[model samples]
Target: MSELAGREVRFRNTDIALMLVAVLPALGVGGYGHLMLGIEILDKGEPDFSLFGVAKTLSAIVAALGIVLVGAQLRGRNATSIPPLVLRSLSGSMLFLLATALAVILVPRSLNHFVRELQPLSVLTEVVLVGALVFLVLSVSSAWRTGLGTLMGINGSVIHALLSGAVFLILMEETSWGQHWIGFGTPEAFKGNLQNETNLHNFYTYRFELVYYSTAVLAFVLLPAFWPKRLPQMLSQLGYYVPPTWFALFALPVCGLMYESWNIIPYQIWFFCGLLTAVVIGRNDTKLRMAALIQAALLMLSQLVFLTLGHNMEDGYELSEVREFFISVLIAGYALITWRRATGEGASASST
Candidate 1:
């Protein structure tokens, strides 16, 4: 009984500590903005150099701590909520996001260099998307081979097949349907698009980008982190796919971008809700705690970088490209995880 009590105390303390770490970004950035700069929740004004500097400093500190925590996690335990392959893909994806952030911070003017359409970054993003498409297709095949459809009394291939189609569409958009490679011209109708590209997204999809962001939050963050264990398990038994909670961190950076209009109370709440949700989801799970902290750190760092750009960000056009790259990586990681789950290999399924 005494040992059990001691363990409970340790768990509580760890929860408190992790909670504080998760909210450090909000406290540091929001506090400084409101108290020192007198910026209100509804104020659309920009923070001065002092506030920006504080945000940058705080973000840097938290991001460094997150990296340290990741290193510690790697050293302390071989166990993780994420599959080995999935984790590797996520690591590479995060590197790309971080590299983009660094380029924006260190050389603000070089934003175009990293984000310009058809650049190396764009090519890399397409490659990842292709990889993801293949994985989703394979997942569908695996489902069929495993007879999940017959077992579940529904078409198991439907979900993943649709997912594959979605990814394929995204890939086509990214490549302008191979027009750049095939040397074809954009249709006259497409000439009115912002980029005048053959891609459908250039026409109007970018205008409703929040739809994409919101969908990601729902699929990756909210669903995975908050849904009960039985829910995912039941769905899996039914031939439905649910993202594992481990994905919240990888998805947080993209989710964080939704609130750049800092003056908007709703957007702030949106981002913070997701932030807090990720923390709550990880409260007791060791692997999830690591994931939440690392993701929260990236969240802070991304907020700082983009906020500083402000009006100059051109409605976050360039930043969106970087995020899309991250999203592609995330999708690939998800496909990997899904494949593992279907095959009953790798890490066990996660729950909140």
Candidate 2:
């Protein structure tokens, strides 16, 4: 009787309610895709099977998966295992980033003077990316101090170290070795580059952009949501950081808005609806629900501004900057959570 009662408490009618809410949006996704297809045919005199259209379709499919996953996960759990501080930090970061995006889109002229090369919004991208680097560095230190290297194995820190090095490389490449702010001229060798930037990424960007997007999606979204629970917990015990499924709340924007061509109302609606239902539903805590509501609203408003006005902006490249900023946020959050987990101060009260 006690076991049955506990099961009932964990999986309540509210869980079902949230699942239904999520299903409504999932149902609309297909019809919405068809409608967009019809509209494209009308406007272009044929269906758009171009690269951009294909990318958009792929994004829609993923968004649908996101909706379904969120619902399924919530239906099985009483409440999220995410720590209050971590959840709040993720929500606050999303709010701030999305708000900044909307402001930049609506008032491009205001930040024009502050913009640097590849930063159509402001220098905020660099600042945030640097912040991510700081967290990663701290994570490395925490891992060593906790003897994670010895605890897990001889090479336990291998993954963390490699990740930090990769991020550092990305930062240096993005900043063009400080040429963007320091106002230095590109060297003779790099002057021949297509963008006339000192960075090497520009030369092979098109080749690796897809790989970067795919890796981020897998690492931040799919792995957390779908991987077996035991695997992640085991990894955490072994000093490898595995993000909780709820991290998807913070990752949806990155997945939906990574590519400018894939940024549209369909993806935006999918993102907002998924986030709103996933965060607020199935949680008994009023404060957490209210916080989630506010963050969801900010995400929706940001998408609205982008779809309505920013989509038509002359420089599509600016959209990538937004994606990069969110990626930085993800990295920072992951590092913080990792550090906590490594030091036996896990963020979540409940086991993840």
Scored by lDDT, the top model is: 1
Across 56-139, the per-residue lDDT of candidate 2 in tens digits comes to 555555555555555445332233455676577666767665765665576744443434455544466667667777766776
lDDT of 2: 0.55
Mind giving the per-residue lDDT tens digits that candidate 1 earns over 306-337?
67654454334566567677777778877887
Q: Per-prediction RMSD in angstroms?
A: 8.9, 7.8
lDDT for each candidate structure: 0.59, 0.55
Candidate 2 Cα deviation (angstroms), residue 210: 3.1
Q: TM-score for model 2?
A: 0.64
TM-score versus the correct structure, for each prediction: 0.68, 0.64
